[model samples]
Target: MVKEPAVTLHLTRIGPSWMDPITNFLENGKLPDDEKEDKALRREAAKYAIIQGQLFKKGLSHPLLKCLHPDQTDYVLREVHEGCCGHHIGGRALVITRFSISEVVVSDNGTQFTNKKFTEFLTGLGIKQKFSSVEHPQTNGQVEAANKVVLLGLKKRLAKKKGAWADELASVL
Candidate 1:
């Protein structure tokens, strides 16, 4: 515990969620054509509808790549996205409604976990962040499943189309 990592890596990729449009439809109360839709906006929107975290894994992974040094931090908080995606509260809340609000959440020190502002948000909101054992991915089962579904949806939709995966994701997802 004496040696601190310079940067703790938490990697996650958010492509597209097929259920995005559905949620938009429900939220917006109106529909727009493809040309009128916002790709960047929708991609971010997907995060909200399907914002599930890996069972025991941190949510954000982008910060992992920006390793200023290999050894600096006292610990590693491996997560995907710290503020929104890493937490996975939206997705859990969607399914469980009031159940997950009362469940215990354990986590290791990923970037999302170590963030001061994020921690303060969790504390103010009364959300729990617990650190589990290292490398035990099974804890993040919901995230794994969610990632798989997104990947599968992307493949199934774009497989028959003629365009870039990212480009086609809005329509498919």
Candidate 2:
């Protein structure tokens, strides 16, 4: 009998599975000031423990931004590049982003990335850029899937405190 080749899969846990404790602490019914303070401290300590344990692990993690402004997009890209590629910049990775106006400019002739500055930044880092088709998300399915996980985690963590998503992003990621 012929043996089949082994398949290897890599998985990264971006956040801790301490949602119940966090939710309980966040949603603890109107408690006394002292009790609430104690709970808050405990929750923070728990979060810190989780974060410390997972620091510098290999993963594609990004913070939740309130908007997709060009500056914000650029910051996210820089963070990803620094965290993932480190000193080895050029041609290390092909970045695929959605066809947002801030990311890519659409023209009758042909579509191109937004501007020289952003292009030069990527070139300096030796990274290649690719844009997903305007209407076809499947072109970046892997990234979209990872994004879905991150969004879902953010949603779960934020719960009723939707506006606090940005604040809890680090913990969630």
Candidate 3:
């Protein structure tokens, strides 16, 4: 008779999730030793709930939004970005992959676009940043026309299913 080796399998958490502290506090009344940390945890835990053993954060639009672990966030983002219903034009990947160095970049006067690091990058690349002016009819008209086209496309793609508009946005673009 031949002897076979036995394999042992053990389940383990890849890493401690952001929700661990809140979940532990809500479930088991456990709190951190630090005074400030424990108080902060208590305050934050009030915004979350344990429903059917799953953690959910309170939201504005909806009552609850299911919270996912850090490890699972990437998978969820990928699915929403490239899955069957998704068109893959949105998310951080869009900024990373689709952008090209341009001579003149037109953008709104948002803090993000005007930040020091972004300004330094543009200056280093010799790119001129043009902030779209509300007073300029020509620039505003062009932007409005572009927006109209996109809105029309989205409207045609989704007649009554307004919720799927995000997934259909890249296809329209």
Candidate 4:
């Protein structure tokens, strides 16, 4: 009997520090005696959140240019596909990701994945792309769970150096 390839989902996200201040303010209302400083922090955090939300709405999420260049993305996808599929050319593998434009380009109006080059790249590598359902995270529950595990591990490993997530990613992984 032929065994099926093991399916895997790669998950990535912006660091927690980017959203912590906003979440703290949301839950606690405001900070004591430092209203002006707290307000500024909250505003900056909210701005970042809004920008991220807009990007998500436009089918663009993690693995941004700063995180991974398009060429690097192609390389990583190829490596992961081959490694997970026993290095078989034309082996079938499915990749599930948020509607990140870095992974999949949506049309100008956000109606569809309109990037022919990306589609062709996947086709060439015998890989299939699936986007998590809008507002339904259960579709990618395993990956989500894995993300939490990684974050927890990183939190413990990094301690107070939160901004060093990228630097410590290799050890975390």
**lDDT winner among the candidates?**
3
Q: Which pairs clash inside model 4?
A: 59-99, 60-101, 61-100
Q: Residue 76, candidate 4: how far off, in angstroms?
A: 12
The Cα error of candidate 4 at residue 17, in Å, is: 4.1
Native-to-model Cα distance after best TM-score fit, residue 92 in candidate 4, in Å: 24
Candidate 3, residue 81: CA error in Å? 1.4
Report the error of model 4 at residue 154, Å. Answer: 48
- Which candidate order results from sorting by lDDT in descending order? 3, 1, 4, 2
Residue 156: error of model 3 in Å?
21
When sorted by TM-score, best at the front, the candidate numbers are 3, 1, 4, 2
TM-score against native, each model = 0.23, 0.18, 0.42, 0.20
Ten-residue region with minimum lDDT total, candidate 4: 105-114
lDDT of 1 at 147: 48
lDDT of 3 at 5: 22
- Tens-digit per-residue lDDT, 86-154, candidate 3: 774556876776668679867655565567766766677799987889687688667666556755875
Point out where model 3 deviates above 4 Å.
1-13, 87-173
RMSD of 4: 24.1
RMSD (Å) of each candidate, 1 decimal: 25.7, 22.1, 18.1, 24.1
Tell me the TM-score of model 1: 0.23
Local accuracy of candidate 4 as per-residue lDDT tens digits, 1-173: 74752443355654444344554555555553587877687665443323322221112554322223233456567766666555654423323332333343221212223355545544655656665555655545754565567558756666655554344343433
Native-to-model Cα distance after best TM-score fit, residue 76 in candidate 3, in Å? 0.9
lDDT of 2 by residue, 9-66 (tens): 2344324443434334445533335877767756554432223222111223644212
Model 1 lDDT-worst window of ten: 49-58
